[model samples]
Target: MTPEGKALLNIVILGLGFMVMFTAFGTCGNIEQTVIKSFNSTQFHGSGYTSMAIIYAVFSASNLIAPSVIAVIGPQLSLFFGGLVYSAYIAVFIHPYTWSFYTLSVLLGIAAAVLWTAQGNLLTINSKDSTIGRNSGIFWALMQFSLFFGNLYIYLAWHGKTHITDKDRQTVFITLTVISLVGSFLFFLIQKPDPEPAPSDASESLLPTDISDSSSVVASQGLGSQALDAFKKSIQLAMTKEMLLLSIPFAYSGVELTFYSGVYGTCLGAMSKFGGDAKGLIGLSGILIGVGEIIGGGVFGILDKCNRFGRNPVVFLGMITHFVAFYLIFLNVASDAPVAPEEGTQMQAYMQPSVLVALICSFLLGLGDSCFNTQLISIVGFLFREDSAPAFAVFKFVQSITAAVAFFYSNYLLLQWQLLIMVLMGFWGTVTFFVVEWTAMSTRKNSDYASI
Candidate 1:
């Protein structure tokens, strides 16, 4: 196969690998609260939410060092090792302990930082400006399929019941472990691209020559030097006006994701009258989210490829969708509503307006999320080009910190307050996107004039 054909093939394989890994680990991440709440609410003092906060906090910290780690090991090896760390974290459930759980959270955090940093770098470096949106869209859509199958497995495991038996929990752990292992193995099949030469004219590059060269340079010095340089580059990028403007929306996306993965399932479980079987209701919500994401990704990718809409318009639509979903959630659903069984048959209960509203909220959240996330990656790739590793690292850094803060306060806040905060953030994010787009257009016009 030609190099171009091989590159495309590798991208698809990597996407499929992530789909498997995410299905396994994503299921654990999404539904763990319900499972933990069911098994031993006292294990963390019913503070699974706090545990997640701790993980993202550590993840935020690790982002500072992750880029250097990827620089040393390369993206493919970084992904392989990171996948193994994820599998180990999943295996922790077999012999559960409080200390072990928190310890693994730290490991998972570091691993996540490495894995995602590598992924963004790999995808950006391999793609061209014209096709970047489509690549990201296809990749995200495929990865989200894990949510569908993972939730499907949970639904089957519960047997339409709300609570999970000890046997079922054990089976879940084992199955997830095996699936993660398979994903790690698939990373070995990916071939890393050869490094491109540094641009001759520094004026044409977004990054300095030293930093651009750093991408091709291995860690020949001591670990401390490599880390120091990486940290400096991260700070430099973070301080750029474009990066700051883009960060507002990126950080808000983090909070939105935390709500869907952490709080949404809990809300569904709380409203169900079927006892432990209510967990199945949460699974159903996840499936709907996956379906929405698939549709959103496909549509956005097509529009982008056809030049039907600019990135700003698509992102604006996403912000509006998110605002509407949150508003509906605030108005129609009550987390503290009494859990009396429906007056009629099971099907009638399932068809209740409030329940249906919650499900639709889940779908819209996923759809809006896909629109923003795919565009965020594509836009960053377009702006930064060769210096994408540090740019993506900073992006993840801001997102992690924001998400950590959201999860930390999540326990203290009521559902109404949480939704209100998200609405406010969404508004600010949309405004910031407008600023970022305007800046980009101005910069491009000047560059064109200079060329003329």
Candidate 2:
């Protein structure tokens, strides 16, 4: 075997490229700090909150399609495309122009979307049978670095500035652009096994069969029609009480993303009246998540290992963690702290204990968040046909589409701090947890994205 094969050197190297993929997506979190700052800078003006919401909506919505495109183009080409967007539009290598800034946000959304599909496909494709499980472990473990790296990037950008000025923003953009380019170039060198053979039965299906071919597929003929068809099929298949319960966890996970990636820090700022330092806490929140992932990561694998239990318990654990974590945040904000047991005397409700509790609670929230993500992608592979890239594409698409709406509701519509609000989010996950448990999906290694 070539060194790249015997040692899987290329996959190892491309992990950096994948790192860029994640950081690209992760930059979304920084929007709360950056977008508002840009508008306030007088470099741009208006209630940019709407603009921010639109950007997020675009990011969330486009990410779904990105994977399907990645499935078709292959990872290297996708990375190249993603890199170009990062360098050109995101201007992470230099101060992006205002037009570039707006354009970059759109492109970043699209690029991030593409990266999700491409990297997941790539990583799964690259894993040699002996190494796949180990790689999966490393994949999740290493992704933590993206959060760390992104936070560091923001820190340096604001080293001396009161806020991230346009100049500072431009600097950050330029850096990522160069990095994207470098990562893109490297992808051309990495090789993996071709995806599993296209399903023979697909020839019998009404949809186009050849488009699923990775090397030959084009970007324009979207799965637009296929997406709807697949949705109906998945819905039809998922018609059981257990299937309905599986939907529960997804809602919680969706809300968690909105809160953490989309609005936690901003919410913190909204609570500025309470002396809460939202911005200062934003970067650190990732640490809480990382710490949580450590625990969840250690434990979730065992759940994935249990063949008889299927994925239910692990998925359940992840969902429960997320649900509780969000609950703490919800309660912290409302501070029914010191509910006055006697009901006659007023007590100083806002105490240090409550503050510490909220912060710790936020950390746990991140832990559950991490596990859910790890379980989620794996479950996608577990739940569907390995060769069914088209189906998984649909899966990814709905996830993004739904979450886009979730973000809209969280910040754009119901911008309030309440535990009941989280229940709405929890509804999806609660259903999903049961669905996976009750469903009879096989956990066999999918041959489609399997080995070289």
Candidate 3:
């Protein structure tokens, strides 16, 4: 196969691997808070929220060292290792204990830092400026597709049951663990692009360059020094003005991610008056979220390939979509629905809960999330082409930190308050994102005119 073919193949393989792996992890994750709550032990009280918070917290801190680690082991191996860790994390669900749960959360966090940084680096290496947007959309679309299958299984398993049993949880998780293992194995099959593109001359490359090309840097330095340099480089790049500003949307994505992935479902599951199995409804909601994400990702991916799409427009659309979703959530769901499931307590929503409206909000939230994430990936991948490992590390760092904060507060904050924070973050995040994007465009245009 040609180098381009190889690159495309690698991206597809990564996407497939993630889709399967996350099918297990993400499905289980969607029900985590609810399941932990089901434990009915004071020791595991609030464990779901706390565990996820722990994962992201460790994830955020580990991102600082991810670049250095990747430099030593290479991204593909890093990915393989991360996948195994994820599978292990999922397996623990079968017989979960408090110590094992929290310990694995920490391990999963570290693994996430490596996995995502590797993913970003590999994606950047496999793409040119023209294809980055499309590739990111394609990859993300594939990955998010997990939400559909995983949740469908949940819907089938828990469908008519008034309460989930330990047996049901075990059966579901066992199936998930096996699925996760299959996905993790696919990482080992990923072959680097054959006849890899030679490192571009930094001065001639259109994007700002950094010292992250492992092949070029590691050949000349000891492993220890190379690791230190990569770490330092990531820190320096993160401190750049453009990156600092971009952190706003990155953090916003985290908050929104927390909502869509965990809190939204929790809210729905808490309300039993919706005239159907609550777990089933949550599953259906996940399916819709997947549908919305796939539509946005497919549309944007195709349009960007034809040069009919732009990042700013998509970002604007995402913000608007999210505003609509948040508004709907505020109106339809109870303000206290997400805190915990109270015994014999009636749901006190702002308005009567409509199943249709809740599902619509879920779809919109997913679509908006894809818009922000695809654009964010394209932007960082394009602007930091040479330093993608560290750039992505910083991106994940900011995102995970915010996700941790959101998860930590999920147990305390009213749904309305959380939605309000999301709105404020969405607005400021977009404004700041526009500033950097516009500046980059202006700079590029000037460079083009100078060349002419």
lDDT of each: 0.74, 0.50, 0.83
On residues 1-452, what C-alpha lDDT tens digit does candidate 1 reach at each position?
76566556666777888989988888887767666655643554334567678878888888888878876667788888899989988887665667887888889889988888877887776666656777788777888888899888877777556555667778998999999889988877776544344535534332222312345343345555665676677788889998999899988988998898877776666664444556676777888888878887788864454344357777888998898888887765564421222221132221343667877998998899988888788778777766777888888888888888888877777677888888888889888987886676667764421111
| Candidates sorted on lDDT, descending | 3, 1, 2
Winning candidate number (lDDT): 3
Tens-place lDDT digits, model 3, residues 1-452: 88788778888888999999999888887988777666645555337788889999999999999988888878877888898888888888787877888899999999999999989988887887767887898899999899999998888877765566778878988999899889988887777565334654643321122212346555566778877877988999999999999999999999999999998988888777764577677788888898888888887764563244247788888999999999999999888888856331256577877989999998999899988998899889878888888999999999999999999999799888999999999999999988887887778763321211
**Range of the 10 consecutive residues with the lowest summed lDDT in candidate 3:** 204-213
| Overall local distance difference test of candidate 2 | 0.50
Q: Which stretches of candidate 2 lie over 4 Å from their true place?
A: 1-15, 24-28, 31-35, 38-43, 46-52, 55-72, 87-89, 92-101, 127-136, 152-171, 194-252, 269-278, 302-308, 334-359, 412-419, 441-452
Local accuracy of candidate 2 as per-residue lDDT tens digits, 205-316: 3222222244222344445544454345544534534334444454455556666665554444334333433344445555455556545644554233543454456555
lDDT of 2 at 361: 64
| Model 1: lowest-lDDT 10 consecutive positions | 338-347
* lDDT value, candidate 3, whole model: 0.83
TM-score of each: 0.88, 0.71, 0.93
Off by over 4 Å in 1: 40-46, 194-216, 219-224, 273-277, 302-308, 337-353, 445-452
Candidate 3: Cα lDDT at 450: 20
TM-score of candidate 2 on Cα atoms, chains taken together: 0.71
Please give the TM-score that candidate 1 achieves against the real structure: 0.88
Residue 385 CA displacement from its true place in model 1, Å: 1.5
